[model samples]
Target: MSKFEQQLNQQLHDLAKEKAPQRDLWRGIELGIEHQHDTGTVPQNRHRRLAAVAASVALVVSLSWYGIQQTSVPATDHPTGQALVKALSNQHEQQKQALLVQYTDAPAMTENWEAQLAELDEAASAIKAALKEDPNNGALLRMLQQVHQQQITLIERVHAPQWQQI
Candidate 1:
């Protein structure tokens, strides 16, 4: 035969000679079936399997419950967080009211100054409500602080002499 054909034949022969699995898996299955049939234990095995599945589910649920309890913040921290937010908001409102009263007689550069302040108040209230829901959220607290600061700055800027000219 040619060199290429000889090589192909050798490859085919090697493929044909590949060994099968070491053990007969079907024999083991047949023996198990026979044993179950002779002993009348099929129903018991099914029940055992069901019990194992139920135990695994219970274990998973217990672990999840433990994880949630562990990850939750301490109960004492919740009130403290809300209290801090409350104090800051009270202080902000007092300052905002004072600024509004101070600038009431002053000529505001913007005609819609009250409307703008109302918008800021609305935004602050929304943040405050969100904080009530998630008291420990630092970003929400910071945003509330920023909105209050903006209100103060707006009041000052609109009543300033430079803004009046512009």
Candidate 2:
């Protein structure tokens, strides 16, 4: 290497050393943040409070819904399954009425929902006839109850607002 080139390289290395800041830049950033808070432009505490209230309202609403669902069915059980029949019938009727009200003017997603509901009702009727012949038949009783539940579910699915395309 030439002496002049070596000296130039040494000078570049000396100039490449780290330069210190003349003032604390962190203090400027801290003050800017503090000014925003003081001016109420950024409500740091308000955000937390709003988030907490939303969470609390969501929790309360979910709990209330759960409680309502839990209380819908009575705990008393009839030995002959009469209470079960009564409960299923009442629930089915209520759901049917609600669906009718909701879908009286609403179009169904499926074209054959009425036929499907009719088929389920027919099955329920056949099961009910068998149940009348042998009221103690657990299998027949369960089948009838299942049919009722299916009808309710089908009605709910067809009449749900979310299912409406518009």
Candidate 3:
């Protein structure tokens, strides 16, 4: 044979020799049956398989129960969140309108000062109500702090001596 054909034949022989036999599953079963007959107790380990199956079933049931229980909890919006928002908005609007000046040509503007003050007081009361609802809300608490400061300043402004020292 030529050198190339000789090398190919050797490779093919090696491949054929390396092929492993198929498994004889029935032989293993026959051996197990013979062993069982000899031992009379079978050595089956069925108890271990049963325990594993039971553990898997228990895990499934526990997970299913947890999923059901978690789904049943009702989520709701906090009423305090609404109150906090209202208080913040009320303070914001009041601050915006606090700079209003009486128009000299508008009689209605000059005539309604007391009524406007009453409305502002009502707004302040709403802010206080919001604070009562959400005492722990940071935004509401900060607004409340500002409200107290504004109240003190307003009182001081009203009570300060008018040109007495001047």
Best by TM-score: 1
Compared with the true structure, all predictions reach lDDT values of 0.87, 0.79, 0.61
TM-score of each: 0.49, 0.45, 0.26
Q: State the lDDT of candidate 2 residue by residue for 17-65, as single tens digits.
A: 7888999899999999889988886685788889999999999999999
The Cα RMSD of model 2 versus the native structure comes to 9.7
Model 3 residue runs over 4 Å out of place are 1-117, 161-166
Query: Residue 65 in candidate 1 has what lDDT?
Result: 96
User: After superposition on all CA atoms, how large is the RMSD of candidate 1?
Assistant: 19.0
Question: Better model by TM-score, 1 or 3?
Answer: 1
TM-score of 3: 0.26
Ranking by TM-score: 1, 2, 3
lDDT for 135 (candidate 1): 89
Write out the backbone clash pairs for model 3: none
Q: Can you tell me which runs of candidate 2 are displaced by over 4 Å?
A: 1-87, 161-166
- Show how many residue pairs clash in every candidate, following the order shown: 0, 0, 0
Which of the numbered candidates is closest to the native, going by highest lDDT?
1
Better of 2 and 3 by TM-score: 2
